[model samples]
Target: MKKFFSISFVLLLALSGILAGCGSDEAGGEAGKKIKIVAAHNQTSPDNPYQTGLLEFKEVAESKSNGDIEVEVHAGTIGTEESELVEKLKLGAADVVLVSPGFMTQTGIKEIDLLAMPYLFDNYEHWEKTVDGEVGEEMAKLINEKSNNDFKLIGYWSAGVRHYYGKKPLEKMEDMKGLTFRTQTSGVVADYWKKVGAIPTSIAWGELYQALQQNVVDSSENSYPYFVQQNHHKTDNGKYITETAHDYTTRFLLVNGKKFDSYSKEQQDIIIEAAEASVKAEREAVYAQEDEYKEKAIDDGAKVNEIDREPFIKLAEPLQEKAAKDMGAEDLLEKIRNLK
Candidate 1:
């Protein structure tokens, strides 16, 4: 598997070079020429919030610009992996894409990972307050400047709130002890789960169904819409869900900054306006899906239980502080904490 992944990375690198060379040498030139922005996301599901958001962007931009701007949206057709999509964005093969902060951190700007830290927000409101506020602005600046303006964060979206689903319900923190839980294998997520006595196991998103079915991992965590959409609730090991709500997942709608810089001032304003619409549409879709999917999970014979998440939140504070300090975002973390 390691060897396969290594080869995939090499091929993607080669593809990035080819894509960079294939595009017009001048990206943001000649405003009158019909400009096509290739927007992509790795999610194949048409109902996904990412697709909804990207389609909103396409519709608003094309209509408002009167076809001066053509937005071609691809759902998992261009690249089925976010890493590849990010590479395409930098190379100008893809003009815009969605990604989590964890992937952003891999670009060598550690501060972006601050948003991915679990339990940082008390709820969706607190999460929004931080990301839609000065912290979000500062992080956007950091991402653009650090990537040499390769990435411009246009908007923030959510994957709803994440909770735990497993073969058994976690009634208390001690219930996680000795169970192998599939989650992020490194960073603050793993640290928090590990401190709770659950072993953190890394599994590819695509392979998680089989992993859970075969008991390769005893438990896993994700938002209601995501796991239920995948039919994970039907699996033997995925039937019991605990509302940990440990994370209010954040995703970034990012465009190629250098390419965006090349656009006419009017074009830039329209694109930003479209992004605002996309953000609103995406959040509404996700919030609605959370309740819809949770009900569907119950109707499908999957059990749901609520936990007193206060203890979990307490456990996360020190972890959040450590993560922020490590990433040099102590003040930003404090700001997020106070927003609650």
Candidate 2:
């Protein structure tokens, strides 16, 4: 009876070892098994720059892996809400996503909001220097650390520089006084406009056209590509576009860091390559679209004016400093300012 029991225990141990090996084989570097990723962003437009970047990622990953890895790009089909995507990433339902700093703050990483401060970058050149350099690397590290490795910043992209468009063009700082300006929901953006004497109002991006048509908000700020694509210029309250150039925006391409770490080393390297390619493609798309849409807006009769940006920059300094201190990113802010 003792000999029979020993034989049965040996068989069970052998079987468990085989099963564990099978599990690893099925997950990585195995025949007939592939890693699939769901990549998503909240831009609904088929031609949006986010789509351009994500599609490139899918293309590169699939081509490099020779069918070992497949990426599915969901352009707002998965979720139009950045918040929803962030939640899905945490739940392991989504693999990759794009998000702005404001929405990122909702994840409890308020230090990221410093990127959204007014006059953060002097121009696209200064903007590129900051975000493509050491400052960007540190910010990416903070995101991953704060999220407990739930979020990994793969690459940085741009949404073009933001400008002010409203009922009338501003020739001086005093023009902003008393105007109801449509801006971000909160954070340093709203505060900056408020300091300039404009009453900052929050309006949903999709609902903004009607709000402007009905005078719910007298003015709004955005890049030419965004506002022109939505025809914000056609509205009576949006005809005059002033080049305030307050923000040179940054968007992050993030992946589920834990999921990323779970990937095989070869697969992880392939994904990093794909992300680098996508970043280049996305930035090129945004820069081209900025000029293309600006011309379109001008042809569509949206009056464009250049404001003296010096006073506005001066107004933004104290506000930027306060916001940086509040977010505990004062050093990061100083690095960015010095980058310009």
1-340: candidate 2 lDDT, tens digit per residue: 0000111232233223322332343453444347999999987777788899999999999999897899999998888777889999989999999988988998999999988888888777777777667777777778877898899888887888899999999999899999999877578887888889999887777688999999999999988877888889999999999998888899988888777766765676678778878887887888889889989988998999998999999989998898889888999998988876
The CA lDDT at 123 in model 2 is: 76
Instruction: Extract clashing residue pairs from model 2.
Output: none
> Across residues 1-340, which tens digit of lDDT does each residue of candidate 1 receive?
0000111222233223323423333554555556789999887788888889899999999998999999999998987767888899999999999988877887998998888887877777777777776777777778877998899888888988999999999899999999999888787778889999999998777778899899899989999888898788899889999999888898988999878767765677678778888888888889889999999999999999999988898888888888888889999887887887
Deviation of model 2 at 57, angstroms: 1.3
Count of residue pairs whose backbone atoms collide, per candidate? 0, 0
Model 2 weakest 10-residue run by lDDT? 1-10
Query: Candidate 2 regions off by >4 Å?
Result: 1-32
TM-score result, candidate 1: 0.89
* Highest TM-score scorer: 1
